[model samples]
Target: MRETGLLSLEAKKRHARTKIHGYYEGAFKFTRPVRLDDDCLSVYLIHVGGGYVDGDTYGSTITLGEGAELAVTSQASTKVYKTPSKPVEQHTKIHLGADSVLEYFLDPLILYEGARFIQNTTIEMEPDAVFFYSDIITPGWSKDGVNFRYDWVRNKLKVYQNGKLVLFDHLLLEPDDELEGVLQLEGHTHVGSFVLFHPEASREFAEWLYENVFESFPDVRLGISDMEGGGIVIRILGDRTQTIERILSHIHTFARRELLDKGEISWRKY
Candidate 1:
């Protein structure tokens, strides 16, 4: 079955809150907005079925009105179970108004053996809006105890500002034949990525991220670069999931405090 969800938030001066005006569908449910001391709304996306199954399709759309601030995260990592017949697919779309802020720092996606999945995310924002996004991919538990056993996995991310495309990132991993090849995992089992698109993301910030954040983690192979439209992109490869998660979390926390002027607020799902 196909499951769909939609959410729209607008800033209301009457109560100084970003209220959710539109919501639809099930399985892809969201909790009530939690007001943070930083005046930003935090919403958690919950998968009612717990994980993805064969032939399952899910879609979600989120929009932020002008001057609105919102932080979105998932209740837990997206688990992709074994699918023999068909692959599960998920699509997400985001829109940001002028001067709005959006933080989408979600958990990783774990793929079990025989699991096949595809994910596509598109973002359109105004010139002055701020956007932060991060994602990770890790191998799930297998009976054979071998890593990178998944059949196929694909992820695509596209970003646009003021109707001009600025970033397009794509990744495809099929570890059936050559798992240790240089073009594949390159002997790494886990991969993670982080992106920040804001007006203040200068080359200096990129250098600072490489020196301060990436340098702190000596085990992981990290790469940092500047995007076309004043954005920062980071890629990481590691053997342990916890190590990669910690590095990305630190970057997110630092960005929140420096760019959004907000203290780190933990999202407790358990």
Candidate 2:
């Protein structure tokens, strides 16, 4: 069976609202939006039978008003199940106004054995706009019947400013594919990345992130590069989903307090 799910969030006048609309197995329709309490914006996902399963598609969009501030997070990691029919798909879109700020700290995505998934993220920003976003993916759950040898996941990210493309990221992973020659992965099963739209910052900050949070993980490889229009991209490859999630949370908190000068997101309490 094939299914589609839609999740969206929009911000205007510093007020953030979100909605989820879609059906699963043609038996039920899902609709709801968790409000952002303070700090910015956040949305909690709903689980079906304790997991997010096969033939599922989810898309979300977020917008920021001029001079407004917003933050978004997921209440839990997205779970992908294995089935013979099809894989799951996720898509996201974000927009930021001039002088506005957006920080998104998404939870990791867990892929089960025999599962295949594709995800895409697109961001549109105005000049002088600041934003931060990250994505993380983990291997199959080890405690259950799941295994890692047959799963696959792909991700694509694009950032634009003033209608001009600035940053493009394409990430793909499959057990059968031979990427051993490349410096990527290097025997790790979990991967995470952080992309920032701030050009005025120096290389010191990027270097610091690698030196501090990533210092202890020997199996993880780090990559830092310049994004179009003076932005920055940080990529990490590791073996543990919990480690990657922790690193992402650290970066998100630091960005919120140090970069945006706003406290931790209030909606997280709920």
Tell me the alpha-carbon RMSD of every candidate.
2.0, 4.3
In model 2, what are the clashing residue pairs, if there are any? 40-71, 41-71
lDDT of 1 by residue, 103-134 (tens): 89888999998899999999999988999999
TM-score of each model, paired residue for residue: 0.93, 0.79
lDDT of 2 by residue, 1-270 (tens): 233555455556523432223333332222244455534444444444456576777666677767666566666677787856877777788888887777777677778777788888898999788888888877765666443644778888988999998877889887754543366676666789888876554477666656666655554577777644657787877777777766766666665665667655554534
Stretches of candidate 2 off by over 4 Å are 1-3, 14-38, 47-49, 142-147, 177-182, 212-220, 263-270
Q: What lDDT does the true structure give each of the candidates?
A: 0.83, 0.68
What would the TM-score be for candidate 1 when compared with the true structure?
0.93
